[model samples]
Target: MAKALPEFAPLSLKELRSLWKKYRGNEDIERLVLEVQFSRGVINEVDDYFKIIHRTWRQENLGELIAIEKLRLVLVKQHLRQTVLAEIKPAPKGTKPSEPPEPEPALVD
Candidate 1:
């Protein structure tokens, strides 16, 4: 029989953002290089830009970018909702609960 894998918690917003930044930052750096090349007239043709960017200039990239952005918005909304709920239902004050009074002794026969 296969062993069961341990359950893992979902990634927090901070973790997700860190991961996104680590990946997207590299892509952004590459894109900036391309942008500079274009500005300096180093890349004259669309084909050259595509070749340098290591992509075939497909519209799929734009669609994926939009989808990822939309997912980010949803994550933000959920986080905000959870925050509001937590604030709205704050925990009870830190007071020691009083003990119940001792039961009265049974009446003598």
Candidate 2:
């Protein structure tokens, strides 16, 4: 019988962002990347937060770059919507998620 696969917890925002950035290149497309993540439901946040950032706090900034960066950050954070989520627990206790499965031996004649 095959060994049961171990489970893995979802990556945290900080971890996810770091991972995604490590894999993804070109900072220019940050907005687009964030938008995709937001739509994926990977980010689940309430509208009130967005209203506060985009509507209230956002008014404080008017510079082009700051405005753009802030917009993207707010969007990403809002979508992430994780206020008090549990930290992704370490790999199921002793299980190693990185280990590869053994290949089946060739059938004998």
Candidate 3:
């Protein structure tokens, strides 16, 4: 871990998107990394509650990490597929969700 992100529950989509856009250098591996972190965090937090996992705290292969990485590709693929298939609803009447930000007035020549 180069730098750790703050511990966040029900992770914020806005923060994740910001991280994904700026911090995630490799778009190809973005989802894979997120899925792994999410999966591993869940397992660790659960074990933390039980207090019976990773006694030595070694960085060797753990079952959860292995399983998450193994399934990551498929999960990412599914996520992408679902997003692509999602419906696009226009902003409600009188609402401005779809509107672009108004441009600044042109400077005088």
Candidate topping TM-score:
2
Q: Rate the local accuracy (lDDT) of all candidates.
A: 0.38, 0.45, 0.42
Q: Which ranges in model 3 have alpha carbons more than 4 Å from their true place?
A: 1-28, 52-109
The lDDT ranking, best first, is 2, 3, 1
Off by over 4 Å in 2: 1-10, 26-33, 36-46, 49-81, 86-109
Stretches of candidate 1 above 4 Å error?
A: 1-64, 88-109
**Which candidate, 2 or 3, has the higher TM-score?**
2
Write the residue-wise lDDT of candidate 2 on 6-95 in tens digits. 854434546656645665665655555465445434323333234445554457764345764566676555434443342422223343
Better of 1 and 2 by TM-score: 2
Q: Would you list the clashing residue pairs of candidate 1?
A: none
Model 2 residue 29 distance off true place after TM-score fit, in angstroms: 11
lDDT string for model 1 (7-74, tens) is 54434334434444556657775465445333323212322333333332243453345644454465
Q: What TM-score would each prediction reach against the true structure?
A: 0.22, 0.24, 0.23
Record all residue pairs in model 3 with backbone atoms less than 3 Å apart, i.e. clashing. Answer: none
Error of 1 at 39 (Å): 47
Ten contiguous residues minimizing lDDT sum, candidate 2: 100-109
Q: Which TM-score value belongs to model 1? A: 0.22
